[model samples]
Target: MYGEGDNQVKALDEVSLSVNQGEFVLIVGSSGSGKSTLLNMIGLLDRPTNGTIKIDGVNTTTLNDDKISAFRNTKLGFIFQFSNLLTDLTVLENVLLPRQIGGTTKTANKDATDLLKAVGLESQINKRANKISGGQAQRAAIARGLVNKPSIVLADEPTGNLDSVTSETIVQLMKSMAKRLGQTFVIVTHDRQHFGEVDKVITIKDGKAFEGEDDPSTASGKEMEVVA
Candidate 1:
């Protein structure tokens, strides 16, 4: 419900789903099928008007504004359609920005460097956002998202801006990291080719979610375990 009675939009209606620990889940839907709304609710970026969202057994709907923000930063990572890196900052600095904002220890510098290397952005660590290709910029964004050691990573159209090859690379990188770190990932993507690569696929249609190979009109969500 977004506005007053008559103007209200029912983005999600009694939508209930669960994502297990260390699972990579995909959510697929049409343009207006409430995919983004679902992500926003799970990511704690928007409050649900009806049901509760529990992350790691903690009900997020009960958290206050400040607490929610802190929880989101510490427990969840976000990747959007755009990389959203600060143009002025170097790639390495952008990856370290989250720690800076959270007043974290400087020791994370090594981990940040390691993440950059893992994303194949090691050589471009010192370059500004303008200096990198779109794919490289997005890889940097992935590194920045992981710097906080979030329990769950939520991505909305993470590969929407890239070519097929780069998009595949990004998803593969995320899958690798999820396995290595034992973290959960819930991503909203429209690319069907990436479907079979995941573990379980949850389809979103008309504000509802269905499991497995449900409908062709809906984007098939797949969840896959990261193989070491």
Candidate 2:
């Protein structure tokens, strides 16, 4: 991207990443390091400036916006730093909205309440979206995303709004749920401590990805590091 003709920025340059089912991957990068840009590309929120993205092993750049949106609704889930709940609606209503709009499920209401319970919010089921803590709101957002049982969940700063302790709890809850549902998770964050549950942590630097050996920074580690 160009700030001006004389000052252009290569937000993401030749970055390739591959994720498999039931894998929890952490993406770490400081601000302006193209972390969110990469996430946006993967989330199908925006097309890449160059290169291509494949979901379910199908190339996506050639698909129209409606097709991409449909694919996203059916195949991918999204969690942002903010919960983005509809403040006027109840938690259950907010969670059910996606399925209702997409015509994906006949039982979104029941699924919403069940997901709320899973997130430790059974009593808050009827609570208005504005009446919850940040963590609770984010949990409700999680429920919204999973209402479709998506194949991949892309989270951009999923725990950015909460305190460190709450962030840990929230991340762990997500990890446990991903394991149970066999969902793939890709999370972007600047903080590094709470990712002990992640399978791998890939770092972005200078418009490219960090590549090294083991996650312990060793070459002999069993897991192959992908970002380069």
Candidate achieving the largest lDDT: 1
Clashing pairs in 1: 198-223, 198-224, 199-223, 199-224, 200-222, 200-223, 201-221, 201-222
Q: Scored by CA lDDT, what does every candidate get?
A: 0.83, 0.81
1-228 per-residue lDDT for model 2 (tens digits): 546776977788777766777888888766888888878888888787777788777688888999988988988988989999999999999998879878966877888888889999999999999999999999999999898888899998988889999898888899989988899998888666776756766677666665332132332223332221
Cα lDDT tens digits, model 1, 1-228, are 789979998887767676888889888878898889989988898898886788877888889999998888899988888999999989999999888888885787998999999989889999998889999999999889999999999999999999999888888998999898898888898885764567767777787776654463544443322111
Off by over 4 Å in 1: 214-228
Q: List the residue pairs that clash in candidate 2.
A: none
Residue 101 alpha-carbon offset, candidate 2, angstroms: 1.9
Stretches off by above 4 angstroms in model 2 are 2-4, 211-228
Q: What is the lDDT of residue 120 in candidate 2?
A: 93
Instruction: Give the Å error, residue 148, model 2.
Output: 1.2
